[model samples]
Target: MSQAPAVLRGQVVDAETHQPIPNAQVGVADNRLGTSTNDDGRFVLAIPPAYQQARLEVALLGYRKHSQALPPLPGPELRIELRISPAALGEVQVTASVVGIVREAVARIPRNYPVRPTQLTGFYRESDNEPDGRPRYLVEGLLTVFKPGYQQRGDDGEIRIQQSRKVDLRPAGQLVRIDWAGGPFITQYGDFVHRRAQFIDLKHLRDYDYRLAPGSSYAGRPVFVVVFGPRAGNRRADFAGQMYIDQDTYAFLGAEWHYTAAGLGRSPNRADSRSLRVAYQPYAGRWHLKTVWWQTRARLPIGPPLNYFGEFLTTAIDTAQAARPDYVERAQYHDVFLRNAVAYDSAFWQGTTTLLPPESLRKALLDQQRQQRADSLFRPTTPSAAAGTAPGPAEPTQQPDNPLGRFFSRFRYGASVGAWPLAVARAELAVAYAPAGYRFGAQTTALITDQALTGWSRVEYQYELTRELTVTLATQYVFRQFSGRGWAAGLSYQHNLRPRHRPLYGRVGLAYTCQTVGRQLGTFTNPDDGLRVAGTNLGADRLSLRLQTQADALQPTLGLGLELSHKFELVADASYLLPLRTRTQLEIAEESGFFLTRSSATVDLPAADVSLRVNGQPGSTLPWRQQHWLLSVGLLYRLR
Candidate 1:
């Protein structure tokens, strides 16, 4: 016999106080029939005679909920009670019965396959209390979604996601975001899996032991309750909250997660401490997530004071349906908030990307792993004995002897001057004596010749020479007038970690300069000479030794960057007045860009000590004059 039609009526009441609860939700499991409890906590439900025997769910904000099978009846007026309780996260259960099903399902998924969730939009409703205790309102919403190339933390995208104080929200229209990264919007693809980068691990569902509990209802409809647990070995994946799954399918019916503190290797790091709920339904052979509710509860001074709550929902339907797949909204709602004795309701679709989690800040991980092979490992792997050519078995471990001895092997150098410490300027020359054993790189430098502040710089290029170190021999020419030609050169044993700039380094060198009395000032040459000049033109000749220090991003691949350098130059040069003494210059003549693009700003600091000797007189002219200070700014720009 067919069951009779029945109208089940009820009043929604807070289970604890038995007080009427307004705007509470009552619905059938996975079905579209649902209603919000009015101000009176009263609701009227019409049950079709054919649709009897379904599950009913009663939900309200800040409350414990209830789910039960429905019975046919216009029966007694029923009363649904919702109890308020602190949210207790459920534990995960992994056993023998359900692991296989999830494993099989996972194996069936293609790598990098964009799930349908990638295509759907998410919308939410929220209400918040204003700082002044005024009621706030946000209602009905829509969201549009898309796949975005995740980059750093900045929010520049098609659309963003949001949630409000209300207890529920679903997918609406226009904008949506999905990020697999630890931050908001789980949009990252599967390639991010296994990388020791961000902490969110969306790829380990099967490995994490996701499944329904043993006592769940398992009829042909196969209703079951499942929980999700984290995998060992890895520490955190946003510590996402627990999830409730449909026993019959791995589809998530509900989920609760809170973000944690900053991940390891992160700057100004922080974790997510907010709670969230996600719900899904099966449609057309695919699972469509329907709603998501997130409640923000962060710890003091650091966290947001007001507990934030937001809901999101979505729906897909036939062209002729009121909620058309494109035209009609299958979901509509508003943000709910009641605080400081006031309540506000407004639309949640208008969310700002301000608080959203950072997107793909790990470009380095996606970059193909490139480990430089040791010379031995690589060269040895190449057939050391080619057919017809016995390459002596290739002894890659040995360095070709520099037979040149100490004069060459014992000498190393480098020089630089930049914008910190003093706008007054700087310059340096580093020198190192290798076979000589002692490791200090001596320096001689100068800065601000235009301002009358003479200087000298020196340094030793030898520091920590190891298996992984590269050295550079740098030569710089400061102010050089045939009347006073002064040039400097440095030999530095630089260790290059990056093909570009080195953050940490050392230098040393023996430098010499001689300024003559050719009568006229000469070309100032490149950057190093424009500010400070150190030649033996001063009343006294000098020999100096010094050091270096720095920090910056190094792109060993791109082979490009700017370095901030500081140098102590120890001057070493007695003026060379010999006729064979040479002074030359590389001139652009007119087109300066011939050597540098518009993006580069290279300033050559002019420097030279004037010890005049009017034909052997002790005036400021002949002996090499070494500048005590020099500030030269080197700017480089790359069009590519």
Candidate 2:
């Protein structure tokens, strides 16, 4: 049986300007099925029979929301005029200079933003397109984001993916798949408003130079347009764009920015270009994120370009906690990758509001299957080793076997040459393998000295107990010509914190240590005994617990770490390591003046003060006097 949908026609326009407001959202209040207006501010909503009598809501970012009762059946166009929100009209004086307006906005964030807890329901989408802008992959998710409070230093919000779908459209022989797994996750962290100071803090005002453009209107509200770019003396400022600010409230209405020339050098992640546009609106006396759109184009060293686009739109807001936080927590969500998102009944998405049209989605899926079939016929079933052919490019969203990859990608090889405390020059080499939650790795270091190589080699293995926990076992052997020859073994558990700006971690450990100390000339247990033991080294054993954490994201210039041990004391350390410059070298040469050529490349060399450490440990020595500070600098070059 089929029921005819009730057609709701409407035109959304600015109340004062009488101009069409494009892309305004319109739908039945409280329902997921909704539609957006076109460039002409015209919308046609086909409401189901169940919602025919419901109220139709029209909303735009900067304008006041409007609602009206729907007719019983299909109706003629109902005109909707949205006025500039009264909340946006404030007593704040207008500033002719863009810099002044931006400064005021940054200063007023704590005041104008929501102070109490709030929850938001929104739709998120990630799409991939061919060079010609043909859609190839799409994933849509309905998510609930819970914010602790605006005044909080760190965002305690949680993003629960309520429902989601992953559509694959690559051809069979096409080993390349769109990077879709972490798209949603990236968008979640892309909430720059929550991380107030990270992108545009008052302290970083010097990084950007602002210019005031002519005033304009957005959603019927008067706006001051500010054009910004890197400051004359600052090369690190990598963003250039314009920001629209509400004239009366000094609040940000919208902004669009793209990577500048300097930014391209910092990102060697194949991101040739990147841009984002964001908008905010006042809802119930508190400002809220209305929309976020991010686009990027990645070009590999030897492949066609891959384009990625992601968007998030807030459809509803609940300041009173109407919806329970029953969904999965950040830890649980972090453990699951979006690439593994399960498919659901078509009825699932049919009930939800989405940006991608159904017809377009189906066509993309069919195209993927068609391309896969064509590729399967040409691609060899097995990989070739004799031909020295490298494997195809790994999918960007592919998950590592280790569950930790859910939080961050794992590294395979790394090397660092820096100075160690008491050692003028030292270098380290690390090779690790972590798959399926089992980890094995070895690290060795050598201290360059006048005598000989002196350092330690450590081998470790980790067994993932769960998504947030891991069991680790390790052993270390120290090598020194005239120093203590010893070995240490330990067992520990590491837990990674979740849903926060700064990476946090805690570990509880137990260890047994032994060191062969030089023996005294004579040693005897019994004073009166005529026997004495001599020329033998003494061995020592001990057990201890250690807890440590690093907070770098919160304060880039200064980082604090603390380590405590049951063996008797606490060790506190502070460090500052900032990169001065990042350099890259590319070289090309002809091999025997023929088609075959020998090649090598080095990508980045970041110079930083890698050895800046100030530590205080009262329980470290009997005399309570030891070296507590060390500073050194080094340059690290990549080799592959």
Candidate 3:
């Protein structure tokens, strides 16, 4: 087998200002093998043995192209600087109408761009953050894309994910979730030349006014810079920016534009602002899309503004080897790329030739991964030695020395307000502790309402299936002023939906609950005598009664959480209980002037028809064994 290619690392900067030049084209001269500098003007390229003697070229629009012989294998990092081209400084004058120049460039697209299919292998990255600069979601991947030539307008192209990793930082419990659905495919849609953006569309050319800006140089060729914007009173115009067109061939080199204020106002995505950049490189005598960068801020009605950034760089391109991706491998237009992320592969990232992410982003990604590992309930444990052999030294436990300190470190505290129908409202306090893959918790709740005094207490256990999912089992005891005492048991599944807002998370849960309603005894008035009475007696001056019930139900829950600080989160949840089975009983304790009747028979009743008598008169039906809804809002505090 042949040896692996030698790696080349370098940075490019302006020759005069010494400032780094981002997105500069860097590659082997005349070869399709190339890559672009990242935002920091840094790059990593692999040079095969065959290209050891070949020259490397670095070019950027407005900058004179730089070329030099390849450095020796395992050489020091290369630092190259490019000077501004004289032609770009307006040393050469242009006398043509800028509109005609732009028009000609648009007309030359069929000849300037490829007419046959091509394949691209590249790196893609997309990230979004909250208004305060907190990271929300990030996904980066290596991709294989199949592109139908510019002549074909209907084919949007296809992309296949090769390797990917994602980080989701949205905490659980959020009311609003934002998702950027298209992922890297957004780059394809941003290809204004092939997609015929309104500004470049031949039929819509008359709606815009174009003016010649300063001249420029791209890929060593002098180019004309034409700036265009909506004409006065043109309500349909949406974009304003500048385009680079080759002065000699009229081939469009690149363009940078942003949505106008009016366009932003009418945006369906509620965009606060949006901008895009698209560039092309001449390959084998035809121009091919080289890079796409897009950024946008969305002003949602709820929560802070969300910012998004997407970048696509063409690392290598192939026409001869181009082929369509398999149907199953193709990414759907509406697919959420995060759902397709695979396990993080350190090896692939280490060896791949891709654009380097910004230092801050890299640090954030690492910190997020570290935090996840720290918060994970399950951790790898050392295996025991074989049966016949003595055990090796026990692996050191990475924990605090004090047992009590370690024990208390696992606890979390929270408080919430809960509500149900029938004027019942409650305040709940809870505590939880997780020492391993499972958690144990308890809650105490006190109800305050006009009709009754009540309290509930519950103990629960939760087993984590993953970072974002859990299985829960709980049991509770309920006590009411007039309704007596009861107990319930339930099992549930909960999932966290990671939203784009860093401080918020949305949760969904389903549970099955089994409960028993104990005896409920209270005094009531006899309608005929105007005297206090209880228990099914309509004529007695005073009477007493008892009620009992049992029920099984399916409960569906939706919850939202908002982060208040590092140690606290505000959470709210709503749930509806649908009954599956119910059994009820009503017993008259005193009736017809009889008191403390020891031989009285209990009366069985249909749960739907049983109504409790209150204040010596008929009242609303008993809540036992009936469909109902629960709502709760609270704040959770982390103990450690």
Better of 1 and 3 by lDDT: 3
Q: Write the per-residue lDDT of candidate 1 for residues 1-640, one digit (tens) a residue.
A: 3455578888888767888987555776433366556768898878876656788777543455567788547578787777664642332232332343333223323322223224445443433323342212223233443322222213222223323222112123213211111222322211221121132233544335444433333223333344445455544443433444333343434445544342222323222345555555555554444555555432334212333334544533221212212211111111112111122222221233212232321121111121122222323544545555655433223222334422232332444332111122122121221112222112222221222332323222332233223242322332222112234332223333343322332223233323221222222223221212221111112212111111111111112123232122222222212132332211112123333421211111111211222233433222223322233332221110
Question: Which lDDT value does model 3 have at 164?
Answer: 72
Return the candidate ranking by TM-score, descending. Answer: 2, 3, 1
- lDDT score, candidate 1, position 283: 52
**lDDT of all predictions:** 0.34, 0.49, 0.64
Off by over 4 Å in 1: 1-94, 108-122, 126-141, 147-221, 230-250, 259-272, 299-304, 315-640
Candidate 1, residue 469: the lDDT equals 38
Q: Using lDDT as the measure, which candidate wins?
A: 3
Worst 10 residues of 1 by lDDT: 549-558
How big is the positional error of residue 423 in model 2, measured in Å on the Cα after superposition? 24
Q: What is the per-residue lDDT of model 3 for residues 336-448, given as tens digits with 9 covering 90 to 100?
A: 67556355554565466434454533442335664354223122233554455554433321322444533443444555545432233232211111112212111222222
Runs in model 2 lying further than 4 Å from the true structure:
1-96, 134-136, 171-181, 186-189, 197-199, 267-270, 321-328, 331-337, 341-343, 354-640
TM-score of each: 0.30, 0.45, 0.44
- How much is 43 displaced in model 1, in angstroms? 46
